[model samples]
Target: MTQHILGGCLCGAVRYRLTERPYNSGLCHCETCRRTGSAPALPWAGIACAAFAITQGAPVAYRSSARVVRSFCGTCGSPLTYFHADKPDKIDVMTCSLDDAEAFPPTEHVWVSEKLAWDVLGDGLPAYATGERET
Candidate 1:
């Protein structure tokens, strides 16, 4: 049996499916992520661009920076995916957008140093000050 990652926008205007499990998924609390997501950290799900596809309404784009961009629903305004223009073959999805978000839990926390004043990240996942783990 194959487990497909399925989900859509809040207003049901958009939907998508992925046949493969995320190669890597985690929570990111970097300043960029915090501001773009408007949350302490955005939970991400990664699937090969080839394995990811949207079968419904189109998602909007926000050029977060020169290196990164975000996609979301124009109707519901739900943050959806992140990707680097230079790295076009893959995307970091917002796990919350998945119909069954419980299928994926964060494996790690990125950018703990800039988390937030009142954000309590207590899931026991090893916290990283940046992308790499501290020695």
Candidate 2:
């Protein structure tokens, strides 16, 4: 049986559902993610764009960078998803927004170079200084 994942914004103004499981679950320590999420690192689950669908209110989008856009609940200010124009097929959903956040565990840490010294959250997972893991 396929498991369906349901999530929404803080105020429930925006809700979404994932018809399939997500991959590339990780914690990003890049400055962009930290500032956007107002946290040391942001946990995300990468899902195919086709598998994700908005079930409730629409989220406001902000062009964070030249190729990146972030979406948040306009009514409740809850950060929701991140998208890169270059990778239109994939969308990174904020793990915290998931109804059952505990069910997803980060498999790796990315952008460790920008990771704050105080933020240490690695449970034996692979760490990458940059986006792609060094071979």
Candidate 3:
């Protein structure tokens, strides 16, 4: 059976679907992610752009950085996806937006160097100081 993962914005205005299981599932502690989601960390799952499709309302896009573009639901301000120019074929979807978020737990923590000083990371997932993990 073909796998389909569905998700939508808080107001249900924006909806999306993934045709396959995503990869690079992780928690991002980057300052941009923290501020964008208004949370301590943002959980994300990476997938090929071809595997993702917006099935509902269009999301408002914002150029978060010179090389990055982020989208969200204009009606409810729910962060949706993050795209980087460097990775033209891939995009990161906010895991929390998934209908079954519990099914995709983060595998590691990235950008931990930018994490809040008081934010305690007791999950014990491998923490990386930066986005480039030593492979």
Candidate 4:
């Protein structure tokens, strides 16, 4: 999407390219997302798994759930991909990790209700206070 943006982990040990646009690009306030992102909200978007590839190193994986596996660079510890056991066909990418991050603006925000008061965040996108909200 946005003329095919590309990105990788901080160490360049992990790399990826995306030809299709990402859907649901916004902040997620769910507890699981917050832990992995180590942020008040995780900015992410869904993309077809087929459109993504690890062009570089073999990153390590951390299981967030029995059905979900999160990928990150073993060397740099940069959060990378979110693969789901149930879905099997798509993955969620961390938007801030993109090499060409300027290509997309968050269209919506999700899980606003779970956010801690100290972590104030804002964007023009639609905001929701719960995990059920779609970005």
> How would you encode candidate 4's per-residue C-alpha lDDT over 7-27 as one tens digit per residue?
888889888888788866777
Every candidate's lDDT: 0.86, 0.92, 0.94, 0.80
Q: Candidate 2 overall Cα lDDT vs. reference?
A: 0.92
Ordered by lDDT, highest first, the candidates read 3, 2, 1, 4
Ranked by lDDT, the better of candidates 2 and 3 is 3
RMSD to the hidden true structure, all candidates: 1.7, 1.2, 0.9, 2.5
Off by over 4 Å in 3: none
Model 1: clashing residue pairs? none
Q: Write the per-residue lDDT of candidate 2 for residues 1-135, one digit (tens) a residue.
A: 287899999999999999988877999999999998889999999999999999999999999999999999999888899999999999999999999988788999999999999988748999999978899
Q: Specify the poorest-scoring 10-residue window by lDDT in model 2.
A: 1-10
Model 2 CA deviation exceeding 4 Å by range = none
lDDT tens per residue, model 1, 1-135: 287778887888888888788888899998988887788788998888988889998999889888888988898788888998777898888999999888889999988888897989778988898866788
Model 4, 49: alpha-carbon shift in Å? 0.8
TM-score of each: 0.89, 0.94, 0.97, 0.84
The lDDT leader among the candidates is 3
How well does candidate 4 score on lDDT at residue 83? 86
Clashing pairs in 3: none
